[model samples]
Target chain A: MKPHTLSVLVENRPGVLSRVTGLFSRRGFNIESLAVGTCEEPGMSRITIVVIGDDAKVEQVMTQLHKLIDVIKVSDLSENERVERELALIKVNAEPGTSRAEILQIASIFRALIVDVGSKSVILEVTGDTEKIDALEKLLRQYGVKELVRTGKIGILRGSKSVPGSK
Target chain B: MKPGAKILVESLPREGTEIIFGYPGGVVLPIYDELYDSSLRHILVRHEQAAAHAADGYARASGRVGVCLATSGPGACNLVTGIATAYMDSAPIVAITGQVPTNLLGNDAFQESDITGITMPITKHNYLVKSAADISRVVQEAFYIAGTGRKGPVLIDIPKDVSTGLAEDTPLPEKVTLRGYNPTYKGHKRQIDKAVELIVHAERPLIYAGGGVIASNASAELVSLATLVGIPVTTTLMGIGCIPCDHPLNLGMLGMHGTEYANFAVMESDLLIAIGARFDDRVTGKIDTFAPHAKIVHIDIDPAEIGKNKRIDVPIVGDVKAVLQDMLSGLKKNNAYEPWLKKIKHWKQHHPLRVKDDGRLHPQYIVRALSELVKGEAVIVSEVGQNQMWTAQHFCFHHPRTWITSGGLGTMGYGFPAAMGAHFARPDVPVFDIAGDGSIQMNIQEMSTVAANKIPVKVAILNNMYLGMVRQWQELFFDRRYSFTELPPVDFVKIANAYGIDGMRVDSPDDVVPALKASLDCNGPVVMDFRIEREENVFPMVPAGAAINEMIGGHPRS
Candidate 1:
């Protein structure tokens, strides 16, 4: 099953997030990643969900999401010309020698920021599309990645067309 | 200033609620106190589950939002099954629950439960009202949500403090405006035209209607659509009574335990027009082989239901009544299906519904007797299993809302409480709960509820002294290893009498009619126990996972 990104706009109300996510688990839809935050509107929130399913199954997921009373709109951003990004923090084991310089060069090539530095370890903060993040993480694995965390992918359409109610 | 409890009480009549079924508890005493001084008629029930089922029954019978109330924790938890039943069947009900005080909500206080969290999966929508002022608006919105578009149960949980807390005395909203919850009522023009084209050309078109027809009050439109094109109609269990059982073009209930002719028609049809019915597995046995040759046109209010279980050639999302009306306007009289109708007629004549008569009382015979006495006029509610199937099979319903059963969830104890709710909704008509001995005892405590209120509901127990459906399954599939399916007989008549209700036990075939008549003649609730044949099984059965055409046990003549 291919992963499809869904940009969902919902009311900024208590328990609305659980209502949307609960539907996914109950219906047996596989969610690859999810991100949520308040939108431009005062009482609205935007949630980006990456779900794994075929076209028909994903279509059913969209329809089921619309059934929730708190959901204002659900747009499949995967189909449109869009920009996506994921923020990740990775701490790498860097000795007091060539490993440290090599890690700095790798982070510079990926245009990542060195957010924190210890005597023997350095934490790099990176923001990019999912594929770019995966590529950078793969390069740093040889230096013994110590700890890592990622904010799941969030997406938006490229043009002036915004999800209804998000503006 | 007014208390939230008073506002909650005052909101019911404004929303057209004439009656409610509820049980009192500690946290809800404030609301009950307000109810005591209010004009709303509250019927106290023995169990909270009964209160919810009764509300569901009332909703199904009257085509309005039925209301039920309960206190916190176990009380709210007890309403879960009933709420799920209504949710599965698309019955509109609003359940109000009292909660622990706001401060004690998460502190493991006495009688505290996460009811909203518990019911989130079942309810169409729910609210945990934190403020006293939100009561009126929440109540208005709850009713609106419950009664509109793919109707189902909605819950409102008010903490005890919110109910007793004071709020500004404001007027109830004249109209509810939910930006995210608008439901489409009209069908798309292009979709309607496509459906009409299919109907006009189909050689063997069948109308498969469901409870959506009843929910939309579109039984007349459904009949018109079928008659205008000379197409025959069949129904799911929830779709019973949507078309008159005696209608010449109606093929009766379809799928598992359905009529032989209906299953045959579905198997052979070229076009299947499904209205308001989800393709439940029981209705579409072995989904790949169901309606094998039919190019399906599914019309439902819920967009999610379309293509959920089966592929659709034309999917129309709108209110069933409106879609039918639009399709009718686009069509002319056509007799293209005459040959198809003749084939179905042959099937019906060759394999009519039959039951063996060995001089002992059969459940089907008792149901047929009740059908004859009611004359297609009374509301017949049924519990799950053999009793439900027999009632759906034998009862001749002339109009919609006359047949009520838990079709989706198949909750066993649904009938009696639902029958009481139906009686309250339509007091001018007779209501009967056709229950099995096993299922009736699930909520038998409601006998006291009916007796205390003096509601004249008749209970017909088909006593087989076993969990007859499971036994039939075991007998057919597992070499008759009974495996704890049998129950030690308890005197149901004595139990009925103990509740201060009239009751009788009938064993012989001749006593079936007289016992039914005697129960009908009683002024208060009466329980008539019919000692039916223990080994009787509902025939024309499609074994689970088998194709609809692969049915067994329906002999041509019995």
Candidate 2:
């Protein structure tokens, strides 16, 4: 099985998300990650969903997505080379102790930004692929991370390619 | 020049709406008052559910969007099942419900309910109009959406204030533009060419047609394709009218309770041309084993259905009529699949559908008699369960849209009201609702509406005095634990009389035809209650979730 990212363009209407997610769950397809936001056009929203399935399952999910009336278009981004990102905000306990300077140093190495600083804690915002983010989180856990919030994932076709769905 | 109620009433006729089925209450009284004087005729139903079913019936019979109106709260809730019925069956219907008032909506005032919210999952789309100004535009869009590609029900909930408030007169738009809702109507040529190529090369090709054919009015094209290519055709329950039942190439219906030969043909075919059919579970049985040998070609107007249920080797997303027309256009004549036809005919001959004849009346004989007497001229509606299956089995439908019944939802009590609505749509045609004793009583109150409206639709009750299907299941699978399936006999003739309609009760098999003929000859609404064998079961029963070849009680042939 391979990870398939589906880029779905839908009308930004109430309950459209529920309709899409409902189809996924009904067909017993577990979505690994999902991200939804405003698209280039007003009244249209783009949803990027990650699912682990073979060709047969991925094809079925795509076809079912197209069945939804609110869904304008759907494309499987896995077929094309694409750029993907996930953003995480991690609040780590700097404490007055030995690892505070080391935490900032590790953040510098990963190109992470220090969004907030306090005497006891420093919040670092990291943007990267899932693996990079996971690696940074693993390093920061040694410094006693207080809390973490992450957006699942968002993707786009690289260079001159656009999401082609309902036009 | 008029309030929103008047505008709503007038706009219906402009959209070619001739009749509406509804029940009035406090909030919708003003609209009903406007309806009384306007050219739009309204039939007052005993229940809101019947109103929706009647509208669904009208739509299925006439190929137009049917309209139904109901008041707020429970009235709107009652319409839900019927709305869902139409949605599942892909019938085009528009349901209108009145709310208490704009202010009273959140407060839950008298007779107010969130009908739009309640019906969202069941309908194709829904709206809760907050202003009278939007009524005309909303109604226009509602009709357009309801009747378009992959047609289904749409609901519009209006607050009382909106219906009564004055709005600046706005002309109805001749067109509607929804940013999201566009249906593909023409088949892509490349896919059609691929389909034709597959058909040309296949040794044993079969056509599996479904409700989409009827919705697209593509039956003629289906016939041309099958006749031209010499391919055998089998219809799903929804596709019964796609070809005449007696057409030489037509293999009756396919599924559980379907003809044995049809199921065998589907299993044995090499290339299955699925036109507008969704490949429902009942048709497929066990999904993995269904048509295992066939390379499937699925053509539908809605792209969503292409590979949702079954894998399609060739998927063509477009309107059925358009796609079939292209497939038939340069098709070379061929006389292949002779061996396939021979095998199908052998099965048909050996395992023919029949019931043992005793002194008792069989339900099937009544259906057969009705088919013969009507001579394929009348519109037939059926209640769910054995009566529905029997009608599906025995009725020789020779034309499209002549058979209107609940197929997907299988809602009982749907038949009579639907027949009433069908009669209103085609005033000159005879309409009959074949029902079981249990199913008919669910909405028997609609008989009063029929009598009051002077709709001369006939009701033929195959009175078995049980919820026959449930009892059959209990008998076969549950060790004959009858539970509450049996019902104390009620006199349908008396009920019809109380509603001011003439009726009769026939006991013997010999009297079935004469009774049907008498009901047809009657000048007004009539109910012919024919008492059928109490314990009879529908044959060719494939246990649920079993393969198509699996059968329990059926013809005793391999």
Strongest candidate by DockQ: 1
lDDT of 2 by residue, B117-167 (tens): 678668888888887888889889889889998999999898889999888
Residue runs of model 2 more than 4 Å from their true location after superposition: A1-3, A28-34, A51-55, A92-103, A118-120, A136-147, B100-112, B171-173
Q: What local distance difference test score does each model get?
A: 0.93, 0.89
CA RMSD per model (angstroms): 1.6, 2.6
Clashing pairs in 2: A73-A166
What's model 1's lDDT at B217? Answer: 97
Show the lowest summed lDDT stretch of 10 residues, model 2 chain B. Answer: B549-558
Query: What TM-score against the true fold does each predicted structure earn?
Result: 0.98, 0.93
User: Please, what are the lDDT tens digits per residue for candidate 2 over residues A1-167?
Assistant: 99988889998877788778877886788989999999997888999899988888788778767756678888988899999999999999998676789998999999999999999999999999999999999999988989999997899999998886554
Error of 1 at B306 (Å): 0.7
